[model samples]
Target: MTAVEPAGLAAFLAEHPPFEALGPEALDEIAHDAHVERFDDAALIHDGFKEPTDEVFVVVAGQVAVLWNDSRQASSDPDDILGPGDVFGFRAMLTGRSLGPRAVACGAATVARIPASLAGPAFATRSGARFLVETMVPDRRATDVPSYSSVDDLIEREPLLVDPDTTVGEVARWMTDRGVPAVVDLGGGRFGLITDAVLRARVLVDGRSASTPAREIMDTTAPVVHLDDTAAEALMLLLERDAEFLLVTDRAGVLRGVVCPRDFAISPITVGVSLHEQLRRATSIEELATFAGRVPPMLGDLLSRGLGAGRVIAVYSGFLDTIIRRAIGLVFARHPELSVDAFTWLSLGSNGRREAVLSSDVDSAVAFDDAVDAETVPAYRAAFAEVSGVLATAGLSADGHGTTAQAAMFSRTNADWRAAARQWLAAPADHNGAMMTSLLVDGRPIHGDPGLPAVSRVFNDLREHPGTMRLLLRESLAYRAKLRSAWFPARRQETFDIKTHGLLPVVNVARWAALSVGSAVLPTTERLRAASGSAMLPADSAATLIEVFDVLQRLRLRYQIRQYGAGEQPTDVVTLKWLSPLDRSVIAQAVREISAVQRRMDNVSNYVAVEEWASPGRA
Candidate 1:
């Protein structure tokens, strides 16, 4: 392999964005020191398992494939490929992180590597920097996903709300009592946070009298967080505002309490362990049911605190997975004669994708090892029935649409599952094949061996079946227009099915795009993120869908939490009257973007990439 003679390196840089913005001198400097390396065969270039690298590489010719894993191992599989002029490693370099993904040369290739010490200045240019951020980094990688814990959970005491006209002397006395006076409730929901620092600045330095009204000398610009706001959110707000304390309020905007950075609870891991221990000790279906009942309130609290819906969904799924694993153990104990020992219980659909809401239906299947013969299939049916029966008894209704593990169609031997997957992939439109194939596309194991060969393969079994993926996308368009038609009429009403319109289309589009590129990533947010990197959909299109998905999840969770609080059954069909004006506008904007994604998904070329999945190059 040798470097491309297409043009001098500087000329190439002068044509590309970011590099082009670097000006002629910087480009020459970058080109002069840039070292070219060639690979006659695929070789590991940068290992995520190794020490961190402080340089970036651009594909001079052929391709460099990216793979993510903890251990340094060579593989033919590439999560994504960087072709000629495409850059890699800057995201890690700029962020001061390890590579996090292994980069391997694909076949005979030429690559130019440049140290950050040289290329850093070029990337610092306004346009150049924007390119590195907006283009170089996958949007998901940049996400600062805040961890969970609400102000209500963190606050040590109730707030002391004083009259705005309280004497400065009394306020000063409260400051002596603690470090700040009780807050001045400025009526109409605003607050004046008075601290010792405020006393020093406004009274001592400014020569104000102690007899002045408390409100006059008080500092009113401290950051405010809802009592339900996550500790991480509060901390971010405080840091962003350079505040010493946060004024906490209830959902109705009434002042409730206060918290400082030191008030945060560092106890999630402790809480998780405590809960897992409880699940482990749950020996009866009744006991398991009791533990499962706590999930709704836990999730409600998380949502109430403004935790991201995606994170809440993951937490909720984890709760279910724990309960289900215990349920499996109980099944074996009750029916000790069952022959099926090696098996995997699969969570499908919304649950599988970790996009489940408080009201989302449960769907699942089970795969027994191939050694379990046809004679044992009937014997294992009761075991299958028991698993679903336990979950249903614990309030997780099996809405698998006749595809539950209890059915013969779903509970199958390993060989049978793979064979069925292949058949569905081959003819997706026949005999409800599309529906079955779609169900397994996002299959994930919650119990037993996730690597049970055929069971695990079902997750990405549709990767090579681009035609089936296209057919699935084309078929979705059949009834999509009708969903959008109802969406407008339901705006600002008591409620409408936002799930059918706002959520499903985004999920379907991400699903189609993800499977088309062989990505087995589960969550809808991440699916869209992966789709962008794969070029299965335009980055902006994927980003719009991601934003829309997040908004819909948050709205859905909040709506369901209210319903549950009122002793009503949780549902996605929720009222808009309860939403704040800003929230209503946000939902409206989300719907508009969802519609835009709908238009993009309708195009044949959008989901199905015609180019080689990981080819030598693409300009």
Candidate 2:
């Protein structure tokens, strides 16, 4: 009988999974017998041409590149590299195959090469060995992981593929049948894509030949996603390539699957009725609020689904609008005196964009009928206050500062609202006017009445005041973007609070653009396009602003989800430590761009000072 001598190897294997899951005695025996090997970059550790090794190679350091073929027909990136504690090189050993795909190191790396004589028999009998084979085998497939993990992750998928000989008619039919909207032309391995929209407009609408080969009209360079690509990576590809369909392919460049625009499409706020149903089912306001809390998770998932960030805001706002109306309905049903057909429910700021985060305070207002006397107005105000309080009971924080639905100014007649709008526009063109202008610019009628035209006139009034617009831009320029602390000691990772550093700068810049045009639309994207028409925002700034906002929102949404899962609601107050390495870089770029915009605004506003922020400090 041989005695097992295990110490250093046992400690290392014990730290890794599956091996870690193994019983101490088994792990000790396996570790003691494991062979140590080292290889250089692109060095084939194992190949199909050779007999299978009996043991799995557990990566100890550096990187491993698992090649699908020995001929180097295709390759994987270092970004897809696997590291310490990761297991590889056991497939042929498991299947008893004499030949298998080549294996290479991404660089000079050390691995624990377990011999097959001991591993094969142990794997046949030991649970840990079986688990390792099962887990690592599946992980080797590129499709096993999601291309993008979070909403902020860029969307990257390979272009759809088809034979070049395939007819446009057949390609169109295939796209429609598969509901994929696009198909790539594939002969050997590489491909081109033809989108459904393109087929319709270019072939059907343009009266092109149905018999035409798809290769004729197919886009040669469509977006592509590596199996291991993150959501942020995918988005970057989409942005860089300006392509819609993203193909998902394995490390060998062989097509594994695909993701189209619709794969990431987010539905609008139609989920509100179901939420109302859930709310109605609850017996108490607290229960209703708890149910309402479910909305954020749904929104988070939708945002993850590739819903445009602006539309994400719209969808969230839509539900908020529904909840508010539903609350009013519930109030009217219980108290008849609360009934009034003349009031308009308005949302301010983020709510106006329909993009409120999970932990958001509901900022709103109610404009009442003008025919009512002062005595009647008091009663109406009281009734509306009760309604606002009811919303507070249901997870929404009331604007306790009385700037929103709680304020009488918000609950006024059309005439009254018009008068206030005039006052805001008429106010001295300074910080006071800037604040009022900011709120009013974003104020969109969320519920009740078709009086939006009257409200839009306020922006129209402001447009005539160049002084006011300049003042707004001046106020916007008052704050510099936040930076990480410069004095942090070495060894700490440096990251920025994306919300404060990345988002606010864009928000302020976009606000200036929207206010410059008196564009009442609250969405950054929408206002950006609109602001472009009037040259309110520079064309370069407009484009960068959209991308910056998209990145920030996605990061914020994912962070919110992480917090929510940990029994914490999401907040705008983000700490730098929460961001990913990719995100932190993107955020830094956005902040610098924003600062440039602020500098430009400085020239326009004559304001030299802005808010001070820390430099990128060590985390």
Candidate 3:
């Protein structure tokens, strides 16, 4: 190969697959031995009888058609066509057999030929082998086990069927006789599911007559999944629909059985279902705290089982939400004078977004109804304080910034919350205003009325205010310092703040874009999607941002899990030595992408002029 030819070959190979797994040094070695050959239409690049089958051909340009000759039949039709970035003739070269197919260019084309001796060893590397297996081979056994096994595997007994008109007494007796936890109600060509929990909560607790019809208690809207559906699909349905039991059906829409939370309890993360039940049944704060303690171990188990970081965070967040709500209930039980409808408990920051990890602190607030008089204020505050203390015992640390109900700013009336939001919107760049705006925008109700429509109206008003939007955009792009330092290993030599450098940039950008487009979506992923749909951000950029966010989130969780396992306090600052080369590369790429997003936002001249407020000296 000529000196220039090797560089050209390396450049072409870089654009193709399998070679991406190889480093620059390996590619340079292969490029040194590679030779280019040109072929015309109907010209054979290789013939089994004449040429030695020692080269693996990668199409550089145009296309090559592979035709096989057989004793039964021979045709002009090509068995397969290889194009740019596509590899061919490797199987024959690897097996030490004559080429079985004749390769002919469909048109004038260039092909890069590298000796199998060089290609084979490169492909033997772990990354290279994975690329080959993923791209070429179709291994049936590899796909036999899905990320989530089939739901049919969870069904240990046949489903019990009952008519809608059946007496509640008879239905209960039948369920007892069949040894099933639930029964499928089949009546009027429709299916409904009735579970023991529903029976207990609705019929028995409500003191309904035993002779009452079963149809009254049956949940007609219970989610149904096909028997062929995977357990992951069922779990998602359960979460999405907030249902305890899902009716299983066949293609014909006939009820097969019912899948409950216990079915999913087989997975380590899903064990939270049992813990959730216990939390709900607990009468005291200590019992609820004990159940909450199981979350970290469950989180570690899920991570070990190869669950994605996003899903694990979501599961952990669910457990925390359950603990917080149950603690509130226990507090209300102790007080009794405090009305449940009088106030709404708010979850802020990561917890509010449902993106919290094990180390996340408690950032919460309470918005009480204005109807509550001064006499009831003390009682309400006392109740919230008790709940906050229980949450602290349950592993959620109190927010040092005073965002929780333990502080006066967080525990406020509905009118006060509205007033505070207006003040922040008016002067968003003021002391603590920017942070408050970001947190409040992401605030979601955990217990009681959400009052979202009213809160959403406030956000809509802010979206229409150009000055507020400009301040938000400015604050969102203020992470340039962090991004610049993220590129150098020496800068992050001993420790790196994943949240400040890796996560917050993406979070801030997503929030700014979503709020700019008048979306009230809280989660980073969902915000990006909504922004993409609104054309506030491009679809491809939004997708890439989500991908980068996932990478950052995974790195943070993996580091924290290790810290937890080692009996060390989990912190946002991760040691550089703990990261693999791939992890560092992923983090670098994420930081660069976040910086790109920030730069793009900065260049948008269409936004409202912020010369007065967003001057050089401003934050």
Candidate 4:
């Protein structure tokens, strides 16, 4: 559908409440970018469960019916109905979810589809903010994370299903023939999985006859994932469950297909099949390093997909985590005597929060069992040395704060971690206690165990203790963006510390809200959006801060991508003149939103950290 005359579209949009608040330029941009489409009475405008929408629709003629239950319905039975000048699909754009009040044409309807790229200014409008505040629902998730592709999209072929009595040799032959995942049919809709590894382990290693029943050797406890689950979610599920592959099933428990990490090529980062497989199969540190060079292109592709900044950050951080994990595995493979089961590798700071950027430092820590004494410590250190070398070669920088395993303070026994957590929570104002506490609060298990219970307990203590949380909040206030008019300029050749001013404030406050409310969710966007009705942060402020966070993240990521492409160190410094006028304007608005939140925080507490720099400059 090609775009027609913009004058009519612009006029139609101007009558809508949110678009009415947008200026003529913004409205015209949307109009110019829009393509008109006509739908029949029952045509689906959007599928509410697949992925978020990239475009919003405005009804121009006839009627559009909304089905909040996400099921198609007759025009008369719709949850809500809209006529000419009515808008739909903006909520999906804002929330980045397909939780739709599904739209269906009540009759022959004409609608203008405006892509987010063009209608962004409308999303930044005051009326737009008000609309979100009023209509926005506090969305909770099973995991506080994000994704791009689903398991259904990854399933390459149908599963090779064999009867329960089928011999191991027969199953092996079938698997070899189809190159598809093999499953044993156990009747009653239950399934057991078999693989080449299963054949080797059960039949060969155990010296069992190839005539044994496939069902007996099949893995009955094989992991499973829903067809709708994002590839990122499936990847994490695989790690958490220590499963080789997952049985992709529909809602009714029917096995649709089977998927593995290799099948999940499109994580938030677009690590295609070849690159992901290369990372998995690489035997040398140098090879892993070479493959790491290819990932920036994946990151660039992810940004090109128009996913939310938080999702992009999560994807980038996930890629780093997998690289580090693979590097660890490779190092350990050379040393068969070393057992890595008793230890956990953790990601800290921004990476831990799943909010990392291109140039994020390697903020990592290790927690090991106390049983590994002086004798075993040397071996662990030698192995970590190789891990660090691989990481550096892979372009990950060591943390300036010495938060890596190279630092004595960070690499400690599980018992020692518990003790440190107690100290930080007891006297958070002490030397580097605040910093350590914040890192621990944001710490995520990258490899090994999902988490070290000792480290997790530290966060539990922090959450239970309000005084410590308030102290952390006060410390967060130290990170401020300069929003004053005197220091601000439009389209100037100056750099803005987007991380400090634009990002950190929102990140910090959201952290405060998460901790204060005792919600353990990571990701700044999740924290802010989840803090919906709290008095300190009202629904509107939370919504506003979310928008601000997204804008800052978009600018910072685009800037870093440009810098990375130029073969320079990727930094969070966003150059104003390099940005489009709209981007620069959004940054200004985001800064003001952050400032407003900071002002509210000021009224919430007068107690400040003892550090001189942590003190505030009056707003």
TM-score of each: 0.54, 0.52, 0.59, 0.59
For every model in order, what is the number of clashing pairs?
A: 2, 45, 0, 1
- The sequence of per-residue lDDT tens digits that candidate 3 reaches over residues 506-595 is 888888777776678888998988777333366777888899888788888888889988988888888777888788778777777877
lDDT of 2: 0.60
Model 1, which residues run further than 4 Å from truth? 1-273, 304-306, 453-466, 478-494, 533-536, 604-619
TM-score of model number 1: 0.54
lDDT of 3 at 542: 81
Candidate 4 lDDT for residue 330: 85
Candidate 4 achieves a global lDDT of: 0.72
lDDT to native, each model:
0.69, 0.60, 0.71, 0.72
Candidate 1: tens digits of C-alpha lDDT, residues 448-530: 77778374455465656667766776765443412332334344355557788668878878777777666778888877777
Global fold similarity of model 3 (TM-score): 0.59
Which regions in candidate 3 have their CA more than 4 angstroms from the true location? 1-269, 426-433, 451-453, 481-492, 533-536, 606-619
Regions of model 4 farther than 4 Å from truth = 1-271, 305-309, 333-337, 484-493, 606-619
Q: Residues 1-619, candidate 2: write the lDDT tens digits.
A: 1222457777877787546655678767777777777777788776643556566777877788665434442545422466888766555565455334455778788778777665543333223322432343221332223422532232333334577878888887777676555556464557676776578777888889999888778776766667654443343334334455567666567766655422332111123324534554455556666777777676656555545554555556666765676676666566676555657777876787656766667877666656656566667676667777778776777765676664665667777777767766766453355676666666777556647426546766555665565566667666677565542336434544555566766777777676565566677776776666333346676787787778778777777777887878677766556665676666667777777766755553343222111011111
Task: Looking at model 2, report the run of 10 residues with the lowest lDDT sum.
Answer: 610-619
In angstroms, the error of model 4 at 538 is 2.3
